[model samples]
Target: MGGRAFSLNTPPIRHDVYLRLVSKFTTLLQTLHEIVRVAPHAPEKITHGDIDVLVASPLRTYTSEEPIALLGAEQCIPGFPTANFAIYEPEIEAYVQLDMRICPPEKIEWEIFYRSYGDLWNILGIMGKRVGISVNQAGVRVSVEHIEKKNKKAAMVHLTDDPRSAVEFFGCDWEKYERGFGTIQEMFDFCAGCRFLDVEISQRREKITVESRRLRDLRPLCQRWFDEYLPKLMGEEAGREIELNVHSREGVLEEALGKFDKRLDHDMLVGMWGKDLFDKEMWRRIRALLPLGTKRGNIVVRALAKRLEEADLGNGEYGALCESEEWRREREANWTEIAKAEWRVILAAVQ
Candidate 1:
């Protein structure tokens, strides 16, 4: 919500139109960038709603470019790390949307992998959650220490942002995937090919809508997967040896942690005392204890950090400290027994 917003009225284009547009657009983009690629569309995606393209440009410099002048786009909408150019097509007399995504020069491959194949992310992301893995724009992450009480994202550790890691994790041959699929069914098979995929768990409407979008309205690819493809695969995947987290949300996190070097980060997020999460949580409770505005709140936090560092104490051990006579005398911050008890419960997590 805090990020940039741009409204676009570009419409879908036929496959033939898309094919022609991509080539011409590629040539135009090359004039401005050394690395420019049209993220491949999903197989059998005959009518494309937009062209998702990525370019390697540091500082997200491409976001400011006026594609309207260069490519004769009808309008250009600027966004952070992305810019949507509505290309005018005299043939269809409609605007074809072309989105230029900016990535670090070194991350073009990962960006392309993330942006390619329309419904591919939705399929993998939905299935990935059930198996304690997360495939996002950021990269391939494994849900290492999710406590379930907090957002699942809090516990995810980046495995790798490289495309190879994802294909390997999903049990697909990278070369073939790079070559692309000819049909949507082929793409589905590739995703479902992952050893951990329990087709039954994946097909469930409840599991598919794991996030806030409950009573889900399925996207086109997902709609077909739920209402069609998965049902067809039931017989084939019936006797399949489903490994890890498919039947239950267990041990796979530890399994992933054992593989990656993110244990220290995982520990901090799950509540290693005095870390960022612990510091933020402590600051939250302390702020509640003393109803201070922004300016005073900032001063109190700095002072609290100094006190804790000087004492060689963790924030989790400060609940009792907050209730002490010295704390009240120094900061004029006093909490009632009710507040102190509640703070103890909150601090108990990191303690």
Candidate 2:
């Protein structure tokens, strides 16, 4: 349901004009950033929707608006490390869009590669997901067990910092990726070589589910792959193309764990230490120990979360006061008074 929350309708860029702007902006933005470059154009592409510019964040020594001013864009919709800028073109007498993506100094390289070749990663991500790995602006991550239905961020175990290595793990030749694709077909062929890819599963029409990502297949290059290449390949290959044991999500997750050397993380995830599960259990115990309503429980839990580690509780942080030796000793000494204390007295003491 969550789609791109912002959009700018602007005229497409002519290849010649796009080059001019890319050169111009590359020169201008460098004045304000250490690393600045445009993401690669899709091979054999003549016109483009927008100029995708990437910048390393914590701008060299300027304000967030510095790059917009430098590019001479008439308007900008600002975001952290991302902004949409529109420059007026005299020939078309309309705005041409520039998407500025800012990333960490360390991550700028991966971000640039990930954004390159246009929609390539989207296809790769679909292939990765079948194997329980995901590639995004951030690099490789293991999709941990069922925590996404609760907290998506906590559900991921970050695996590696470098995507080139991650890409190789998925079965693409690094040299081919470096040299770049010669034609749109060549790019598709490059994707076809990925070892983790199941041609039948990767190209399934029914698999286009996420609203925003579905936009990738709508692009001209991807549309051809879906409507033409895949169907023909499936028909010609006969029974060989369909996986013998269609990789189940569970099967792939286990495969990725061993392949990626993430077995220790898998053990922790299944051992009741996954953050979401642990917190849920901790809160259940907290509710019982405190015997308080939601509002008061929130205040107490937050205070507990904020407190300094001034005690010797087994877990460093106690799940409930009963887990704290100090609290237990106090309760044992004042059992008669503490057992029947009013919630107001408890709240006052905590505050």
Per-model lDDT: 0.65, 0.67
Error of 1 at 41 (Å): 0.4
C-alpha lDDT (0 to 100) for residue 148 of candidate 2? 56
Alpha carbon lDDT at 232, candidate 1: 71
Write the residue-wise lDDT of candidate 1 on 22-107 in tens digits. 89898888877888887778888777777777877532354355566888876777775877777668888867777878788888
For each candidate, give its TM-score against the true structure: 0.73, 0.73
Report the error of model 1 at residue 271, Å.
4.4
List ranges where model 1 is wrong by over 4 Å.
1-9, 58-66, 145-148, 202-208, 212-216, 241-250, 271-302, 305-351
Compared to the true structure, candidate 2 yields what TM-score?
Answer: 0.73
